[model samples]
Target: MRYAICFTPTPSDPLSQVAANWLGRNVFSGEMVEPPAIRGIGIHEIAFHTAVPRRYGFHGVLKAPFHLAPDVSETQLLRDMMRFSGSFQPFRIPRIEVARLHNYFSLVPSVPCEYMHYLASAVVQHFDRFRAPLSEAEIERSDPDGLSAAQFANLHRWGNPYVMDEFRFHMPVTGPVNLVDMPRIEQALRNVFEPVLAEPVTVANIALMIEEGTGGPFRVHSLHPMGKVSARKIA
Candidate 1:
């Protein structure tokens, strides 16, 4: 499976737990949620139910999926990736309301912070060691969804149609909605999560998350804090 270097929120964070619980309570089937490895975790519940089922369990996608070489163990890669990221310290993410394309909702920063862009770029560049870029056949997989011509072209060129100029940072919430339903979802979210949104959530750390071969539940591998500490580690 491919990997990415993303700053996934720590599992202990209240917000992270909230997001996960929301998924377990509202999305995944009870059977899926019962597994000990995945049960009692918010990300697992969330990752399992959303449109991307295997994506169930992470708030970050640092590296897109890639096959690991026979010699590389996930633990070894994680320890190295963590050391690489930890050397970097931590940073912050702004808070804002964001509209989502998935028939539902989300929250994101009003402005794309320079650091956020840097982090995304860093993941792609630094993690390129394992990536094999999306193949043409992979792009064709989306044909069932009937993408627009421009979108199709982007997938072939960029692996993900939503990156670069098309990128928008968001934390998922209720699934998609029409303008009419937005008000309700927004109010509900605000009522329950006002504390989370009252101020910006600092994205001080990036976490390495892994999915088992093919599509599997995304699990936390390691976390690296951002900032001077991180920089010092790299130095």
Candidate 2:
């Protein structure tokens, strides 16, 4: 199994519900949700667009996934996460916009925030001790040769190349999309998510997620709040 630290919205949050329906899966509950109907896009097309994000659920990654080191235990990681959460306070993103990330689409901040970068960097550095070193096969899968010098160095040092200066906070909404499908997909997302995106969104908690096996759906393992006072623990 591998573990990842992610920023998942609270279960009761409207954004969470919208995201769940859009992706057709609830990461918190590990259950499927029916996708919203779109005039031009078929349910099959919606499912196709969502396939990749559905496996990981609806969240922006903080620390990318890694296997636990042989010496570490899940309990140790959880305890450390609790302590880490107590030291940080929540912040808000003033606005989010739908944008293309390579061939995929995601909700990203209209402007980047230093606090978001700091929070993500802290998570990557703080819990890195628990991460097992990448095996040759794992490194190969990452396609290190395709990475830039800095990214390659980061992958070797931190086990993930997307942290620190490279991190862009985004909640992915679709897999690689064909050029012809982009318009309809974007329209469908805007129709359902416009109202929620009009307001500021809070960055309140960090979710611990687990992938039971390779290519498996990641499920929410636990949630830790980002302020002095922790909320009721959830499994």
Q: RMSD of each candidate? A: 6.4, 2.5
TM-score of 1: 0.69
* Whole-model Cα lDDT of every candidate shown, in order: 0.55, 0.89
Off by over 4 Å in 1: 25-55, 69-76, 87-89, 133-137, 143-158, 178-182, 227-235
lDDT of 1 by residue, 1-235 (tens): 6555555466666566555554442122212333223333344433433445224453644455555555567776766666666555455666655455466666667777777766676665565554556666776765726766665665665456555545566666655456775665556556545565655666777766555467655565556666565354431
Which candidate has the top score in lDDT? 2
Give residue 23's lDDT in candidate 1 (0 to 100). Answer: 46
- For 1-235, candidate 2 gives per-residue lDDT tens digits of 9999999888998899999998999999999999988788888889988999999999999999999999999999999999998788888888988988888899999999778899999999999999999999989999999999888988999999888888889999999999988888888888888878887888878899999688799989999987765432221
TM-score of each: 0.69, 0.95
Per model, state how many residue pairs clash: 32, 0
Cα shift from native, residue 208, model 1 (Å): 1.6
Highest TM-score: which candidate? Answer: 2
